[model samples]
Target: MRVFVAGATGVIGSRLVPLLLSTGHDVIGLARSQDAGAGLERLGADVVHADALDHAAMRHAVRVAAPDAVVHLLTAIPARIDPRRLSRDFAQTNRLRTQGTINLVDAAAQTGAKRVITLGSASVYEPNGPDPATEDVPFWHRPPKEFIPVLDALRELEALTAEAGGLVLRVGHLYGPGTIYARNGSFLHQVQSRNVPIVGQGTGTFSFTHIDDAARAIVAALETTADGALNVVDDEPAQVGEWLPVLADLLDVPPPVHIPVQMARSAFGSWGVAFMTELRGADNTNAKRVLDWSPKYPSWRQGFEAELAHPGSP
Candidate 1:
């Protein structure tokens, strides 16, 4: 199969390209800059230089590539976490998810592409009580103000993909090489500096996906005919209090400091506090069952240790 990947130089796309190549698929990677294009070239992917937000460029590129499938991996994330900058930092990514997604889907539809695999977030799911969130669960109808745009964009992106008979992988909090959860990533730096803290009872559940595992899932999606959304999370869903200390231990840092819920809300805003206190974990049962995929690292505990050992791995 021939595949065209948007955000080909991104955290997941970078890893995914090699996997697709190794599996005997020809790849065309969309790059926004000379350096990104060069990087994809080094990976043996034919490069298409165009920003994802440029609808005309995307349509032309996809039509030129004439791939059997298109994969959307575009995202813009801040280097560091700043609760105050949430809205500003997410604005570009929101645009990418909304406008970029539409462009990619339209390009695929126009080019007669058969498969479209796009990334979605598990965070869009409403809290699912004690259970992990399945694809059937309702989305947060009334999300926090800062998150409303993000969720709205996600919904639009997923809807467009599903309507086109494409697949949407609702991935969990990613944590591996080139991601914020990496050894030298901002999250680690914050934990080492005691900047991120445990809030309230720290009971909010988090489902994690290693970069390698995520790439594997995308590769698997290429061969499967599954449509709509499927959760691509690991086996274990951990609480903030549960994972923070373990991550601190892995980083050789002191356990995270505890703050009152109100203090955390004041410091990190309502969204951040909600992440630590109310968010639910994503269940990957459908992905495993439908795509015949399983994560190599099914727990953050094992994934974090491996990441620390390797420092930087693709």
Candidate 2:
């Protein structure tokens, strides 16, 4: 199969191109810069220069690739977030999820692409529901003010993909070499410096995924005829109170301090407070069954120890 990938220079895309190539698939990556094009070339992927938001350019690029499958990985999320300015930070990413998806899906349809796969967020599920949210669970009915627009964008993204009979991989919090959870990434800096604190009971649950596993799942989805959505997460769902302290311990840093919910809201905004207190974890049963894929690091505990604690130690 000839695969066309948008956001080909991104964390997952960089890893995915090589995987697709190794599996004997011809990969064509959309790049916005010469540097990114060069990088994709080094990975043995053909490069097409086009911005995902530019409908004309994106359509032309996809048509030129004439791909059998299209994979959308476009996003502009920052390494570190400013809680107070959450909406501002996510504005571009929201655009990418909305318009970027439209452009790609439309192009795929034009070129008769058979399979279309795009990324989604597992965290969008309503937190008030079950402990482990499934694909059947609805998106948050009452999300935080900052997240309302984000969820709206996600809804648009998923709806568009589903209309095209494509698969939406709602990935969990990604942690690997290029993600914020990497050893030297911004998330670790926040942990090592004791910047992130536990809010209230810290009852919120988090489902995590290794970067390699995320790429593998995409590869699996390419061969499967499964449409609709799948929650691509790990086996274990951990609470904030449990994982934060464990991560601090692994990094030999001070445990996160606990603060009241009110203080947390003032410090980290409503979304931040809700994230630490009310967020629910996602279940990956559907994803595993649909794609016939399993995570390499089945738990964040093993992922953190291997990637964050002892990277390249052998």
Top candidate by lDDT: 2
lDDT of 2 by residue, 212-307 (tens): 888999999999999999999999998999999999999898899999999989999999999899888999999989899999989999988998
* Reference-based lDDT, residue 61, model 1: 92
TM-score of each: 0.97, 0.98
Clash pairs, candidate 2, are none
The whole-model lDDT of each prediction reads 0.89, 0.92
Report the Cα lDDT for residue 64, model 2: 97
